[model samples]
Target chain A: MKSVMIVGVGGQGTLLASRVLGRVMLDAGYDVKVSEVHGMSQRGGSVVTYVRWGDKVESPVINEGEADVLLAFEQLEAARFLPYLKKDGVVVTNTQQIDPMPVITGAAVYPEKLIEKLEEKGVRLTALDALSLAKEAGSQKAVNVVLIGAMASSLDIPEALWIEAIEKTVPPKFLEMNKRAFELGFHA
Target chain B: MKELLQGNEAVARGLYEAGVTVVSSYPGTPSTEITEAAAMYDEIYCEWAPNEKVAAEVAAGAAIGGARSFCGMKHVGLNVAADPVFTMSYIGVNGGMVIGVADDPGMHSSQNEQDSRNYAIAAKLLMLEPSDSAECRDMTKLAFELSEQFDTPVMLRLSTRIAHSRSIVDTVDRVDVPLRPYVKNAAKNVMLPAFARPKHEMVEARTVKEREWAEICALNFVEDNGSATGVIVAGSVYKYAKEALGDTVNYLKLGVVNPLPVEKIRNFANGLDKVYVIEELDDILETHCRKIGVEVIGKDLFPRCGEFSQKLIAEKMGVARDESVSIEESIPVRPPVMCCGCPHRGLFYALKREGVYVSGDIGCYTLGASAPLGAMDACICMGASISALHGYNKARGAEAEKKAVAVIGDSTFMHSGVTSLIDIAYNRSNSTVIILDNSITGMTGHQQNPTTGLTIKGDPTSAVDLEALCRAIGIQDVQVVDPYDLKATRAALKAALTAECPSVIISRRPCALLKTVKHKPALTVDTDKCIGCKACMGIGCPAISMKDGKAVIDATQCVGCGVCTDLCPKKAIG
Candidate 1:
């Protein structure tokens, strides 16, 4: 893939997703570069991570309209980052909407027609309620892994590599439940 | 593989893997982890110095001794280290010296948004901006190489974005770089007037050589496009610019931001009619280009303050704002405060009540300056509290001095407050110094300090004794008081303030959030005994709320610290 975009709010696993993508790509013998948001966004704001992989990565940043895939942890953030994807690019998104500060404070409205907008724009969109799936898998925190699993299943990357990345990335305690959530998300 | 790590943790890992040998720094946001991480490696010698300038000087000394050294600080801390940074540029270095400056662009955990890049330009040092965690690692390793190669210390700039953001970093086995043997050369090492005058001339020639050398540096690469609108940007801004312009604009992505490669930059600007420089902070890049007789547009469209996003760049670039613009509603302003059971609360509450002048220093205790607490008189920087209090006392007379105190955090006291304490003792001034010993560097996310016996990885280490240090500093009287014990705290403050000689009062308490610190069972108010004197309200605990014209305690929120129990005039809360 030329580029991948991970979208979520602060405290979500967007950073993890970008790292996993970077590692898997690096292991596959592709040069990879990634960028992310830090600082105040860690307090709960929109976060977007960029991962670009190919031969000859120079600047470690992806240009606009160049992302081959947009992996979104939240639906609205997915639509928000839709333009980053190439024309008719694929998007794997969790059907969850995290109310940003503005939405929580009533200054803005959370768009209800996120998937519809992406689909109408000729983008291939797959939406899943990863939070519910994670809850069903016995941990709400596995939502990130579930989203990663969904991306891994649909994006044609090896599922084993993604799982290995998850195992390496997460702490030892919650590995089993996270793996289960990933399996459920992959098949869904 | 992908890892779940805090931004500070990643920076530590980066420094460790970079083969850094000597690390000295004062703790500040977004930048504290680098030194903490350096401490983890057995091969690296790391310590928290008293202040930023001292930290920088220590690192500079180590570099001259032919060892790879580093100093990390937040932006404001850079202001303290600015003296060494500017002078070291002229003196140069024997080994690579990297200064890690993490800037809080939007004032996240900082008092101001001072761009550290301005420091790089003013000091004539090379600056490198890493966009993310992986680069935070890569640029750091590369910074040492560039610093040694150019014989100048390099500044590694991290914004709140890269410093606090986590991402997967490719790990490598540690390569232990032995400290090169030092050769005594007083004229080269020392900056006496005669030796320094010659070095000043060398700096100008060195800049020219660096400019030429930057032309071939691997970090600055050009992305060729058939288009004429080429954009040049460094650091995080490159991410947004690439998102907004894409192939429509050719790019000159400069990883090494300072000592602008005149030849390389001119080559890129040779054909483009409308070239724009995209950067987050001050337009140092644009100013350099303008001086070289190149017309560039930068700060004119983008902002000089705050961070930039794709949408922000798109709107500035005159593109339609994307659907992401309306993601969520604006959040209410919920400014950060001392935690629910914080021991510092009672002390600040007493300070507010007594209306005493307080010259504050850095630490979680600085939250005393926040509204509803309103206790701190001034917070200049680390180690400034005691000295500022001394000056304030000299100006205000004995009565004001008797009521005033210098409030500093425990880790901050260990960092730089000791010297000022010695200064007061030596000068025979009657100044009260309150060390708010919270047992951790609470402001930088509760990292361990010299006073705490724990390392960054939570390993047990030797803790420093504050009372013993005070006694060793030549103070005849040293008293330790539990901050939770308000009556004792007030008495200690009064005694320390009124003492005929310099006195140290250490208000010791562990942070409420430490795992070992257990809160009392939440308190419940007996409404029958409530008199609504509002004394309980004075503590400013969110757990204490008003109900039915009387003070009520939300048992769920209260930690049962009974801070409010003492505040209730009717003794209604149990």
Candidate 2:
């Protein structure tokens, strides 16, 4: 079984990213289970979604130190959830910083050098300014696609399959922008 | 065709395939999507009732009128709908009726962590719990069939894990089911003491027969893995045990949780070296095992409060996870808060400034109790704010009345707060209630309600007039104020607090996240005029933060509500 973890702040389109991942895995004729948090937690809170695929998936959750790939949509979330990644796991992170409530309230300061810190931990890391790439792709909301593109490159999945999954998952109006965003991160 | 479906979505699909014609539900987290998904099917008639009680009664009425019907709500909502459910137990359904109740063990989106299984046993309703989305679909169809076959209403229990999780589900065509003709039998349909006496006898007889069914039902089965030790479990907890223990332990998975089989469980435990019963929240299963004269281990190793994870189960059961290495640094936490330009922000800010004891209700407004705002004193449940506020003031007299207020959302005010407000008026206890009318249900992902002037299907409907309703119920000092206008909101709140009679101030503004509501360009801060003083942080808006001793607003999140603009002493934010 391969376990993938998607971590980000709420309202960052992580749900859409998980849906695309679910689509790709299902198309490969693998049993898949995707778990998500909804309602109150989605209101500007730190949120995590799990996507697991195998011959027969048992649990929908990915426990601590069990994830094969950790996809972070923001820098702070990546550092906070690093423990979920395995010793030999791959990290695909967007170097975008959105200060959580404690930071904004001056109760705590936001940490610095997160990507560098993760890289220093001796893990295979793919880091990028996904927000800027997504903006260049015509919509900042496409950051999820950008990170998915970076994570896709690490896995043995084909680019055509990812594109096909994106095409099937995203709405018609945002498909063009997401495709460009995916390409930018794929080659980054 | 095989498609991925959330458990809630699969239940909706099952409702469609079961030939259900009536569906009524009130929106509650983890359970709202079931009715929302069911409404898409034209063959089914769906509506959002005002409360879970109304929804249950509507479903029961439909069932009694000879149509398959269903209603879904959260666990606490089951308490509100329990009156009908218990009675529906005595008055057996003419057509099948199913109730879907989602329990939040960790209180993810709920105010309390309540288990809904006890409600099934108390109501004498047969309940089936599914572990995955595929079973969510399968058991739902089976629930409708069992409701008919057993001549009783069936309850389908779900939790946050199962309801929100998506898994592979094979779709099937709708099966043709002929509706049973309604027969006028006063003794069975009416539940007065005279008619209910005979029905009471029927319920006892039905339980004995159902126990026989539980013994050999396919939904409750054993998987022999040739292991000495075994685990007995149900619902989503089964998945955790399966992943943690694997084939090292034998399994007895029960889909029908209520009225657990006695002989089957005893047989499964006879040869096992150790028998462990794994359940979340309560020890209902463990208690049942002891009653059936079966020795099992549960609740001793498991905490009775919250959820269970695969890691926790593995640790307790003497299993080991991979010895993995990763980062161990701690970071700041991100809590749910009022969104940027949230309509509730200004009202909560003004209330916080007044230093009043604000009784809060559930919704996005409940976030008022958190963070820098920290305005609300107590928040119990959906409509507790108004009623609890009245009791609070009555207990403390005029001293507390002048220093307290109840803040509720528009949808919540419609749900059950109306009667609470009336209690204050009739009893002549002075109380101030502020209805945060954001024109829609801001929580549970924006479901349409009576106050929204729309139906579940987005059709126009008769909207409830809050002002007129208050006046008709003898509230003289009724006022409306836009929460965006801070000065006016404060004035209205002040006037109501000092008023002699029970007063109501409607804080009217549409939710910023509403699609029809457009946001202006993000406000910019002039650094030259900006002072180091942090006056704008009091609202706790997620968009505003300090950068180099200056207030900075993220343009992406800022909706330009300008509530912070009024707080700036230096005229820095505009």
Candidate 3:
């Protein structure tokens, strides 16, 4: 059984990324269960999605301490979801920072040195400027695909399967750019 | 073929497979996608009714006319439609009718974490609950059959996790089931005193037979792993228990929640060393176990609060979860906020400046209650703003009228706010109602409403004219303002607030997320001349942030509505 947790702020394209991952696992003949957060939470709030696959999966929830991999799309969200990661779990995080409401309202501060702090904890962290890589591929919206490409480096799935999954999951109009984004992040 | 489908989507597939002819629903979180998915199929007729009550009545009328009909709504939506639902329980159906209600146990997008299963019992309706997408599909199809076999309407209960989660489901072709002939039987349909009295007896008799059938149904079967710890669970909680304890604990898994099998649960609890009734939000099942003289460890061990998870279940049972690590640091919470360049911002900013008590309704504009642009006061449910504002004024007399105003979205105004507004006029209160017309249903992913000038399928339709409707409702004072135009909006709000008679201020602007709406280029800050007084942050736009004592705006997030530009004291924002 394998569990992957995708954490990001709302409207950051995490839902589409989970769909691509779900497609990949389903095509691999594994029973896949993916949980999503929708409605009110999608309005610039912290959002988490769970993707699990096995011979037969029971629960769609990936609770605290159960996630094998944490794919984070922002610095603060990455640090916030660290508790969900297993002891030896690997983290693929994008270095982009989006201020939450409290920080904007001067009620709190955005924590600094998140990547350095996580690395100092003896955690295996793969950090990248996914937003920049996505920009190189033509749009910053492809940041999700770029992170997926980076996360693929630690995953055992074939490169061909990842591409196939992207093909099936992404819309035709933006397919070429997302593929470019994936390639750039995969090699970075 | 097996495909991963969300539980709500699977319910639509089941509706299609069951040959449902009419499906009506009002857009609510978790339950909205069911009708949206059903609309994808060409055979079924789907619609976005004005409100849950109208939706239920539509479904009930279709069923009475001999068509398999279904209505879907969030738990609170059931409260709106319960008037018709309770009577439909006795009136029965000519064909088959099913109601799909999804509860928000953790109040994810809902005002309350109400247990919808209670509605099933109170309404005397048979209820089926599914844990995953596959069961969502199967139970929906079975619900229709069970409804027809018992001559009653069936309710399918789902929680947030079950409604929103994706799980693999085996696909099957739609079955061809012709509708039953519509027979004229007023004795059963009409709810007159004499006729309804007989139907009430039939309902009691029906419950008895359904309870008997519940005892041996395959859906209530037990999985005895011969373990001493027995857990009686249902819906998503059952799946979480399985994931946490696996086969270490014996399980009495139930799919039929209402008209619960007492004898089956008693037998399952008899041999176990410990019995735990684990349910989310409420002790509906636990209370049932005790009524039948069964000793079960429930609510005492499991707090009747938020959603239960695998880790919580494991910890409660003295089982250990996998080890995890995190750096010790406090993180700021990220609550949902209004999108950048939201139309509601201008009106809310104006209301905040005026310091008026803004009675609010359910919608994206409810985020007006959030900090910075905090404007709204009360938000109970759909259309509660108008009526509540009227009552507030009537309670305090005319002084409260100018101090308070009701604000509702265009979609919500059409949903139930129209009647709420009518109450203010008919009762002759000096209340001012502001209709935030974003031109679409902004909350539940932009489903078209009666005010949207489009159908659920995006077909052209007649849109409601707010100004004309207000005139017809005997309100002579109707002011329209562009929410993007701060000056105009504030002026209009002032006029309505001071009006001698009841009046309305319509703040009109399309939602920023709508594709048809064009945005100006992202604004830049003239940091060289900026004082960073933080005046622009008053609107709470996510795009603007501070760096090195200067305001900076991210191009990716800024829609350049220039609401912030209007706020900069030094004119630093462009």
Report, for every candidate in turn, its global Cα lDDT versus the true structure: 0.77, 0.91, 0.92
Pairs that collide in candidate 3 are none
Task: Put the candidates in DockQ order, highest first.
Answer: 3, 2, 1
User: All candidates' TM-scores?
Assistant: 0.77, 0.99, 0.99
Model 3 lDDT on a 0 to 1 scale: 0.92
Docking class of 2: medium
Candidate 1 share of real interface contacts: 0.05
Which portions of model 1 show Cα errors greater than 4 Å?
A1-188, B1-18, B40-43, B175-178, B323-331, B453-464, B471-477, B497-501, B525-535, B546-558, B570-572
Writing each residue's lDDT as its tens digit, candidate 1 over B487-516 gives: 888888778777888888888888887878
Residue B174 lDDT (model 1): 71
Q: What is the TM-score of chain A in candidate 1?
A: 0.93
Question: Across residues B1-574, which tens digit of lDDT does each residue of candidate 2 receive?
Answer: 9999999999999999999999999999989899999999999999999899999999999999999999999999999999999999999898899999999988888888878889988888889999999999999999998988988999999999999999999999997677789889898898999999999899888888888999999999999999999899999999999999999999999999887789999999998899999999988888999998888899998888887889889999988788655555668999988888899999999999999999999999999999898999999988999999999998899989999999999889888999898898999979999999999887899889898889999999999999999999889999999899999999998999998889999999999889999999899889899886889988898888899988888887788999999999999999
- Report the Cα lDDT for residue A6, model 1: 86
Model 1, CA-based lDDT? 0.77
Model 3 lDDT per residue over A22-125, tens place: 98999999999999999999999999999999998988988778888899999899899898888888888999999998898888999989999999977789
Using DockQ, give the best candidate's number.
Answer: 3
Question: What local lDDT does model 2 show for residue B120?
Answer: 85
Worst 10 residues of 1 chain B by lDDT: B322-331
